[model samples]
Target: MNRKLLVLPAVMGLAAPVLAGCGDSNAGSGGGDSIVIGTTDHIAVSKELPSPVDPATSYDGGTYTFFNNTFQMLLGYERSATIPSPDAAKSCEFSDTKSETYRCTLRDGLTFSNGHALTSEDVKFSIDRVIKIKSDYGPVSLLSNIQSVEAPDDKTVVFHLKASDATFPYKLATPAAAIVDSEVYPADKPLDGLQMVGSGPYKLDSWDGDKAVLSANPNYKGLVGKLNNSKVEVRFFETAADMEKALADGGIDMVNRTFTSDQIAGIQQGKEPNIKLTEASSPSVRYMFFNVDDPTVKDKAVREAIARLVDRDALTRDVTHRTATPLFGAVPTGIVGHSNAYFNTYGQPSRDKAAGALSAAGISTPVKLTFSYPTDRPATPNKEEAVALQKQLNGSGLFDVTLKGMPWKKFLPGAVKGQWAMYDLSWLPDFPDPDTYIAPFFAEGFLNLNYPGGDIKNSLLPSTRQTADRGQTDKDFLQMQDILARDLPVIPLYQDKQYVTTRDNITGAEWLLNSSSTAQFWELGRGVAG
Candidate 1:
């Protein structure tokens, strides 16, 4: 994907807006021998899955991992108690300068669920296709440094970098680097109608647009082996409430995305025998965007004033019901280069500072700011967040806030064209890298959804990307954060914690912090009886 690659939906996080009218079910049940996962979105298998599945794009891991089980990098994370092991690639070694090159060797005898041999050609095909299609689906920017990919044999793959980058391997470990079957895929075409063919443990059984039927690949020979279940069916719902209803009605067995604080607590609070809610820190951050094209919001002072007047703690605690952490910076927690620039710079939510900033910028008149958020969409808490922001800003007496709402299917286009005065947006990291967070906001960034052109790109972005070393890059990244905090190109609000409700019978459902944050299906089967 070029600059627009991954740019279209970078702001839409994994949390769908299904919780608005969802209610608790007094009863929950499951199929005798199957694990059915429920969600509000469906797979777009039109083209090849982006190697990292473009974390900036909608959740594609449900399909990406079903094809390419092996990853380019694998390492253990200690954040969760399960201490889950990534079943993809075994290990990775970086260059001495963290910028030279990386050499990855696939596990010998690895076969796709279809029994196709997974070789270097397949890897090349996966990455090359993204650059070929030139859409937002691939992580070409992270792969731009690759002078060439030389795969001399089936087991060994070598990446020649144009410049040194220590984090490049991590990018490979992401969903964007998932290897697809080159023989099954054609070159120079959109991946819309192609039949699913991948080396992952699950093979595509059927896709009827709104639903996908997957069968366990008997050929899968890995540490986890084939899935215990015979088939998995995914159904998308327009709302979370309906999904929950379907779960109770035996339409689905699991809910895989974000849930409201009340819903999550109700599950935990009730201790329903068949229900379980697991919480973990996610790499997603919810923030507001200011369209630079809007003349009234174009001023840095107005943006800063808006940021100052809003209380992040209250928003997170009251609005999110403590399901999220008050965030002071755009970079989500658990990543490098995350800083508390918002808290440090603004000190606290203060009407006085907001008024002072506006007054200093020669704005005596109360600025009438129109806030835009998704309306009646069942995938995000956009409506709740927007209402809280409008209330706080309006109550500050420094501005007149009007809330405007639209559905996500339309809101996305409007925000892209810079049609909103102030918009609320959320970001789920495409890759677990600072670049994923920083690059998207830069005017030149392929995922710069806000499109805040000005010194943001000329001064802030160039300075940060110039530093090649990780340590120096850290400094550059902090400097960029400083700029974002001071100008409030978009006010960073809070980082969300992902919570999933499952039955006690489920086990090994670990969340990968990579591009997908997906659960390894094979590793999860029938758990030991309680």
Candidate 2:
């Protein structure tokens, strides 16, 4: 019953890699039962991604959603659920009291969509490949606890951990550990392009850059006993409005990913009579990270000064239109480890306080800085927020800020290279755990802050992971958030209020979430409206 948390924490805007040549806009034959889902969030295909949908190297939640449905994992969450249950494996459990040894037995008759026999070896290959490839943007860090993976026989696999990590099962359920066919995937590199070979609930019938069609995989032998619908079609558009138009025109049956703040406001007003609304008290969050490598921001004083001056009230109320609440910790509100570290340290936005910070460090006035955000992010007010943030920082006279808008493709690479001084990033948990939120900052250098996460990474993070009891992690998580607050490597902005809109006739829209508690593509089906 625990859930939430992610790799590419999401893809409200970023498409790291996806299927190429999805081919044709035509829907597959499912009669009145066919369902089409639309999003401003694009699904895959990028020059940046070496493997289009290789689970080991892939990071986007959108990609995870697609892959989770297509690729089998040793464990998986049931529909509308959080805790991972047996999917590829018949059952999985820690074989030791220390949580260091985990073992699993595959279901009796498992096969990849290609009918290649699925085995413990595939499970071992899927995981070992991840740690080996170690993609900079991938979820390698999530598996840092595992020392080795062993397949004693065709049916059984065991994980030998470097240390006790209670959260390891949840990590296996993520796309990072998604099982790929050893026959199809390269041992050390990603399988190139649109070719995805798996034994999950659905087969990617087709995928073009803008649309993807999925159909039930009869070969699938784990998880759901049967599918709710036989086919699913995903339409990716350039904007939320375009997605909304598709929903209104009956081109798509459901709307997920994003609808701009204004569109959501109108939808909340009950203007879209045929569309149903469901709001999730979500754990989703977004933040702006400083590239500590950047000369201007390298000094902790400048970062702290700017952090003190920037306004969150304006961002939540004016920019996001209250669709989000101010977030003060890496762990957002509604998550188990939530804290108000930033708010506790800096009471509120104040230029005088910001001036004090810089003066204390002997840094001069009006520090020149370039701030950037993804211009391509959908349904979210990222660009507007960037503009607002630029003004807020500049207005304080503590900074002279310029704005740069990077499309999602260019955005991540530039971020990895520390191209922008500071840029915006968003996260959604692949599972509901503090590790999903905090571990990456240290394990993989995914944040690329250039600040070596000394004690937080090597000590606090390991300490938190060593226990299965999430409640016991509260104090440690708080301390970690406080350290982040003091260091100002990344500034918490706001946590989201997620909304999914479905056409009046659609069923199971309320159950749709692409991230942690992942949408069971099979759970969606045609039914009489309530």
Candidate 3:
């Protein structure tokens, strides 16, 4: 299929809003039986399970796993596809040329897990509630262009938009746009705890401590039809070491996320006979954000000098074990409109060039800066990467760096408040769009926290969002990348490659790595252990 079919066109010069899985089967005793999967604690679930499991309220990986299985959306992404096909809706398309009106026809006789009748009213209610509630961490921003939703009939649903947005249909495929039964969930507030009533492939059976038990929903009638396994238990671990040990000990059938570089190296070395590992291209990225409010980073020369002096190739080779791709811009490759703007502007690392940049800004040598990163995050070697950055900069004899490490819980508050002069963080794209990369970081006082003044906040972002044509939008994205490279508000470090490990008996494990960078638990099944 043409990937360009996923790209939506703009109306009124507004290109539209850009925001920003499966498994297998069987043999043997474990074959076609319940499969237990283990994951790191990075999958964010509330202490109180099932109730807060409300799709409108949760936005983390763990919650998404539940939403992906339990709730059905109007549309969903097919494995590895940029465009969205139908899930709950039989068909969906824009009804008007301005892209201001969208219509979807729900599948007939659809019902929730509880046997509640599913209709267009449920679809309208789900989206309207999300916009009305507008939770701080929730994905309300994804639907900011939504004007209203009308359930014209039991099967037909119409959406009115404030502006022409080609990306609107894609938003329906996200976790935030999950359909809910109005009878079970309050329209005003999020469903408290794990009290969920969904109409997807799986239903929450029970939760025991760190594990969630799920069973295939008989009432589920969606695009992803049938299940290889009727039951699945997801186990959460505090660290990759523990998860890896469990996989080795046969305590779990599969493991995903939070694997250290050394752990991956061990897996690749064929140290574990029963375990099989695979890697997929991921859109995840790590970068350093400068608090422009700080006196040291306020100077453009200091930021540029730091960017030039740091060696990305060495960092990826030594620190990440080539597990991550060296990134040159905010928008990673694979996505449309991606550009190596930083590489084109900064070129290769050279101390002389860095020195010249600093000298040109009338700054003396031996500049001192404090870098902070979370020590507790096992997902990436932030601390080790920080050490490498310090060594590289200090080795230049032009910088004196002091590194500070804190747990993520404590570090996040300080980082968001702009308390740190410079800090490191990673972004997993909320949506697969160039706008997701540009808007969040450059929009003044957003995730970048520090204000990125000038064209980025004013003309560039507005113009980029307004251009509806993919070609024009791509051009705007290139301009945005160039602006990011020139401004140096944040330095792109690397893009992560997703690694997942499963037992030899597990079939279809490779297909579970969907385009959204989440696992499709439904696709996993057991076979005779080889």
Candidates in order, TM-scores: namely 0.78, 0.91, 0.86
Task: Give the winner by TM-score.
Answer: 2
Ranking by TM-score: 2, 3, 1
Worst 10 residues of 1 by lDDT: 1-10
Query: Compared to the true structure, candidate 3 yields what TM-score?
Result: 0.86
Put down candidate 3 lDDT per residue, 116-156, tens digits, no spaces.
99999899899989988876546677777789999989999
The residue-by-residue lDDT of candidate 1 on 84-116, one tens digit each, is: 123334434543444466665555666665667
Q: What ranking emerges by lDDT with the best candidate at the front?
A: 2, 3, 1
Stretches off by above 4 angstroms in model 2 are 1-32, 514-517, 528-530
Greater-TM-score candidate between 1 and 3: 3
Candidate 3 residue spans exceeding 4 A from truth: 1-31, 42-52, 364-368, 413-420, 443-448, 452-472, 528-530
Comparing 1 and 2 by lDDT, which wins? 2
**On residues 218-256, what C-alpha lDDT tens digit does candidate 2 reach at each position?**
788776665667888888898787788888888888875
TM-score of 1: 0.78
